[model samples]
Target: MASMDVSLKEMMAIDGAVGAVVVDYNSGMALGSLGGSKDLDLQIAAAGNTEVVKAKLRTMESLGLKDTIEDILITLNTQYHIIRPLTGRSGKGLFLYLALDRARGNLALARHNMRIIEEKLEV
Candidate 1:
């Protein structure tokens, strides 16, 4: 299993990755983070995205959907934001967030790689 630092570093290795973080949705805190520019603050982003995750989870419950979220994607004109909730016992209430440059990133491959990282992450 990969350590949190190792997992976050792996995330930044993805093509176009500008920033990455492992956040605890329950507390809106980042356990580990890597790569962020002046334009992108990983701490603030982590806290703000906690609300996004919580909202989707509530919406799913309200809709009576007995399902789990594979990932959440937010696309901007210049970037793609991917939020992946971790399902492993040690990773409950946590998620991995990645920011990618739209022009340089491959969405399909990023998602696949994130899944693999999530699986190997040891929290």
Candidate 2:
């Protein structure tokens, strides 16, 4: 399995990738982050995304849906944000967030790669 650093590095290698981070939704704190700056602040993004994850989790509970979120995708005018909660029991409460250039990214492939990355992440 890959370590957090390796995993984040691997994520950055994806085509069109701009930034990636592993965050804690409960505390809205990013434990690890790579890329994004100047106009894009990853810490702020991570905190905001914590709310997004919480809202989705709450909605799922209310609906009594037994499905877990594979990933949350937000399509913006110029970028696509992918939020993936680590499924490994050891990594519960943590999530992987990836930002990509919508015009340069292949959504399907990126999702697949993200899954692979999650599966291999050691933490």
Candidate 3:
């Protein structure tokens, strides 16, 4: 298993990664972060994405769907934002957030890597 810091560092190694963070959705707080800049404040992104996750969960409940979310992807002109909620017992309220430069990123590989990272993360 990998520590949070190591996992986050691995996330940054992805091609085109601009930032990565491990966030606690229940409190909208980031437990760890790497590679963010003035243009991309990971703390602010964590808070905003917490709302996104909450809303999706609520929507799923309201619709009576018993499915779990694999990941949430938001595409912009210049970037791709990926939110992956951790499913392990120790990681119940946490998620991994990754921002990538659109032109340089490989979405398929990034998603694949995120899944692997999630599986190995120690929380």
RMSD of each: 0.5, 0.7, 0.5
Instruction: Give me the displacement of residue 105 in model 1, in angstroms.
Output: 0.9
- TM-score ranking, best first: 3, 1, 2
Distance from true location, Cα of 118 in model 3, Å: 0.3
Give model 2's TM-score versus the native structure.
Answer: 0.97
Q: List the residue pairs that clash in candidate 2.
A: none
lDDT of 2 by residue, 49-75 (tens): 999999999999999999999999999
Clashes of 1: 0
Candidate 3 — which residues are off by over 4 angstroms? none
CA lDDT of each candidate?
A: 0.97, 0.94, 0.97
Q: Tell me how far the alpha carbon of residue 119 in candidate 2 is from the true structure, in angstroms, after superposition.
A: 0.2
lDDT of 3 by residue, 36-119 (tens): 989999999999999999999999999999999999999999999999999999999999999999999999999999999999
The segments of candidate 2 whose C-alpha lies over 4 angstroms from its true place after superposition are: none
Reference-based lDDT, residue 92, model 1: 96
